[model samples]
Target: MDEKENSTEVFFDILIKNEVVMETAPLDEQKEYILPDDDYDFHAYRILLLIRKCGIINEPFFSHFTIYGRGKFSFFDFLIRYPFYLKRVIEIEKKPKLLDNLKLRSFETERALSPMIKYIRGPWDHRYDGIFNYMVSKGLIKVEFTNFNKSKKAMCLTLTELGIQISEQIIKEEPIWVDRMDIINAIFPKNATNERIDDYIRKHFPSLMLGIEGE
Candidate 1:
């Protein structure tokens, strides 16, 4: 019929496709709500709202949709696209700590889903190197490539003073800053042991740990 009605129909189709709610007989009998005109941004927002109503998705995915729209992103794409988000999470405690590449890779692999994982093909992909190099060029972070006994090479990342200030300001403006900070604290507590990190991840993100072994 009209644009709103058309959008509602599309939304219903998505819900059915995802099996979020079963298709009912005579779909016309089902009531639909008015949505904004069939624009890409509005459509994406509507899909997110419907998914939330279905109670099927979780954080990062939820937040990612809110921030980046409906375009499916690889985990590397997520990191590259929202480097600041990851930076904010890593520096939530306001300390200039060294975040090793391994830790970053581990976090992404564990948290990102199948679609994202399949898209990125893991953290070692060249796409990730590009993102990091871009951040370096922007002076948002400092990277040090270290060679250990000429046998192993590792990259260490640290936020610059400017980066810290910018991240803090951005985090403060977030509506869910408090809740986000609490989650970060739980994930990376002070003086945290390997056992403690494992316990926290298992307790909080058990779904993410599926098929992933303890570190």
Candidate 2:
């Protein structure tokens, strides 16, 4: 298949996998179009990949990664992964009898997942991002609004039944997902723009990007 067909296929694959795309009556020619760009697809790829990678499918219905933008998340990560704070939280959550000890205030809801983030990247020295906060802006997941704590207080959270179900589905299915960014970014390089992205499509998928010309 050609580039146009291939990319459309990929989009449908995502829609089908998530059960978002369903057959509907055909639309007019003008409506049957999508802007051409590697990063356009990359954005979707990153969001889905990050959600799956973070094992959010297994966490509370209010997964922070799903809710907030990269900036907000960076702030939360700063607090949770700070060497001193992360160490303390992980020790509490990682205990063999964590569920049993949930009664104590120390076992507050954030305890369920925040510590795992700490264990992954300790010492509180990681890069910052705003994408995660954007996720929040998109209303993709449940998240606590305030990011910073002058006193560095941890927030409380809980797992709704839906979260618990999703968690189980992830564990049981272990679905295979290819990070489309691997392909998307590879085509566009690390730094590319809408114009550049459009040019590529015009070059490779002529009919798709309105034909390559002033590249």
* Every model's TM-score: 0.32, 0.22
**Model 1 lDDT-worst window of ten:** 64-73
RMSD of each: 18.1, 21.5
Error in Å for residue 63 of model 2: 5.9
- lDDT per model, in order? 0.37, 0.34
Best by TM-score: 1
How many pairs in model 1 have backbone atoms within 3 A of each other, for residues 3 or more apart or on separate chains, i.e. clashes?
0
**Model 1, span 6-124: residue lDDT tens:** 99999999988887955476877877665333232332222222222211112422221111211111221233323343454456445435233213344554443212222212222
For 91-146, candidate 2 gives per-residue lDDT tens digits of 43354332232232344323432222221212122211243344445443344443
- Error at 27, model 2, angstroms: 6.9
Clashing pairs in 1: none
Q: What TM-score does prediction 1 earn?
A: 0.32
Cα-based lDDT at residue 105, candidate 1: 41
